[model samples]
Target: MTSLRFTSRTTSDGVVERDFTVGEVPGVLWSPAAGPDHAPVVLMGHGGGLHKKTPAQRARAVDTVTRWGFHVVAIDAPGHGERPLSAEDEQVRDEFKQAMKTGDIERFRKVSVGYALSLAERAVPEWQRTLDAVQELPEIGTEAPIGYGGGISLGTAIGIPLVAADSRISAAIFGGGFFAYEEELAAARHITVPVLFLLPWDDQYVDRQDGLELFDAFASKEKTLHANPGDHRTIRWHGVDDGFLARHLG
Candidate 1:
């Protein structure tokens, strides 16, 4: 069991942000400056090329802490952000660049799906270990309810497996930005928790039907599909239940 070591802390706008490491995985946790113990914890995942604390992600984390009094934590995925890239990471990055440069859509999908699969394999256990360490904190004991605060692209790719493998997460939010393979669908089948699946109705690189199909794969009896027009980058989520997590996890 890896223990989280807090390395730094900062506070602003009624939110407290702390940087910590569990073994080699670097993570950031945001909480209300003065909050009750055993608050619901939300695990937020960053997109493919982004680190855990991107401006947008940080904003969301702060909002979650402020509005819902939920602690939000995000970690640098394997070979991403503060973590050094391994040989496989470098190779896949090169492949992605070459495929995009040469306008090879098939090659792009192939390499990206393979890389997403590899990253998810490494990330699931990292998240479980993170939960283990996080639960040890006095403020957030083992009784804290947990949820995955999802994102599009690589975030969803890795999150699906984590939620499937970890029973602690009682509800999850996922989005579509990457190509879905059979394994992802299989994992989805195991997730009995309530899910909110977001889909960009007009993703240029990924077919819209793929998102629909992936949404269908979820075994959650209570799942909502929220589709917004535009690609993943330009999406403006509206009309969806902002209270979804609060309703389920509260």
Candidate 2:
């Protein structure tokens, strides 16, 4: 087992928590030590089954972004982070249950992803308040816009909506954005930010046509796709590099 460690500090109104739980989600708020006034900000999300651990996995990504003068708020999604199990929080739990009952994995996915989207939407009001209060950046009202957002596979739940709702988000990076809501929500069509998508061409789990269609339908002219030649889980190993980030993010 990995021994977890965190160091806490305070802001003005509420206690600033490191390895904190704004609600049920596990999160860490990292701020620029020197320039609280002039830093950019990012709201990052984690993938399915992996919570904020993947952010920890991407240590270079986290360290580099913070050094580049952006405050980072990395959050665990509904089920993954510091949340409690409740019958009331049955949407995701139930979706998992229903899928287990029927063994219809695809239906299970839609329900699961949909449930996370609902929770993410519900959580945004409080999250926005956190952004204003904890980070204490230059323009709380107009902090040069949120620069980048992303997650591995399942974190697209939050990433998709954030891109859809806010024009302020400038760039989005997603890996294994597998599910495409063709009927309910057009995932790719709505994103306004320059999107960088990383996926494997041989992914056995994702619907290949749907994935291609979404990539094809990307509404932003700045959108681009990278394909790795492996099953779904190999992108992190074979797909991207630091040079890729430098070219895209800078």
Candidate 3:
């Protein structure tokens, strides 16, 4: 792993928050000052149009670190957060929006799937590099059990491939996302870790059947689907309880 440079600050509650640069990727790490050396760790990814410092992402990280005494790490996804979008990516985004506006599900799916797959190709490797850098930090113990969590389309798109390829992650929370493409489904089949999948039955962007199908694709012997009534944005606030994360990752 390459050398990492980080700046840290401690909150009143003794939780340490660090901002780091691993090569070109920007990330955040949260750890309890007095937590055990071998405490569990969680790797999280933010939703589309969000960054590592997003309120929802930070809240989850703080909860895990302060309440559960776990180490939490999150990184910005490509073309989001600090990463600027390329002209090609911007064009694709515009195309996706137009497709959605026209209610052209086929075109929407095509553009979305293509863009997601491309991002995943870069994202998975970047996450692995971040993990390598994080493990070298003194606050995060070596060989700690790692859990992965994320929400929305970009999160799912990268996470499915990431969890499938990386054996270090023992469990995962996949929510507010769906698999409408062959590559994503193929990637899902490789994830055998315990997974808690959340689906909003009335999600505007994701079909309920598509979400269920994505969950079904997981080869995990221990997988649970929690579906609630609401749209994508609201359902996450309702379905993802503190206890759910505690049970799976704490």
lDDT for every model?
A: 0.93, 0.58, 0.81
lDDT (0-100) at residue 128 of candidate 2?
55
Clash count in backbone of candidate 3 = 0
Best by lDDT, which number? 1
Instruction: Summarize candidate 2's per-residue lDDT along 1-250 as a digit string, tens digits.
Output: 1122344654422223256544334567655445445445666666666756453544643564554655566766555556655564665677778886998877877776676666666555545544544444333346444644566566565666666666666777765646666531475577766777776677756666645676666688887677767766655445354343334444
Clashes of each: 0, 1, 0
Clashing pairs in 1: none
Pairs of residues clashing in candidate 3: none
Q: Candidate 1, after superposition: displacement of residue 21 in Å?
A: 0.5
Off by over 4 Å in 1: none
| Model 3 Cα lDDT, one tens digit per residue, 1-250 | 6756786565657788888888888888888878667678888888877888888788878877888888888989988888889888899899989998999978888888888888889999999988887778765656677888877678888888999999888898887555457888898899999888877788776677888889899999988888788887766455355665567655
Worst 10 residues of 1 by lDDT: 240-249
What lDDT tens digits, residue by residue, belong to model 1 across residues 1-250? 8899999999999999999999999999999999789999999999999999999999999989999999999999999899999998999999999999998999999999999999999999999999999999999998889999889989999999999999999999999977988999999989999999999999989988788888999999999999989998898988978788888888
Decide which is better by TM-score, 1 or 2. Answer: 1
Give the CA lDDT, 0 to 100, for residue 177 in model 1.
71
User: Candidates' TM-scores?
Assistant: 0.98, 0.73, 0.93
TM-score, candidate number 2: 0.73
* Stretches > 4 Å off in candidate 2: 1-17, 20-26, 53-61, 88-91, 94-103, 123-127, 138-141, 183-187, 237-250
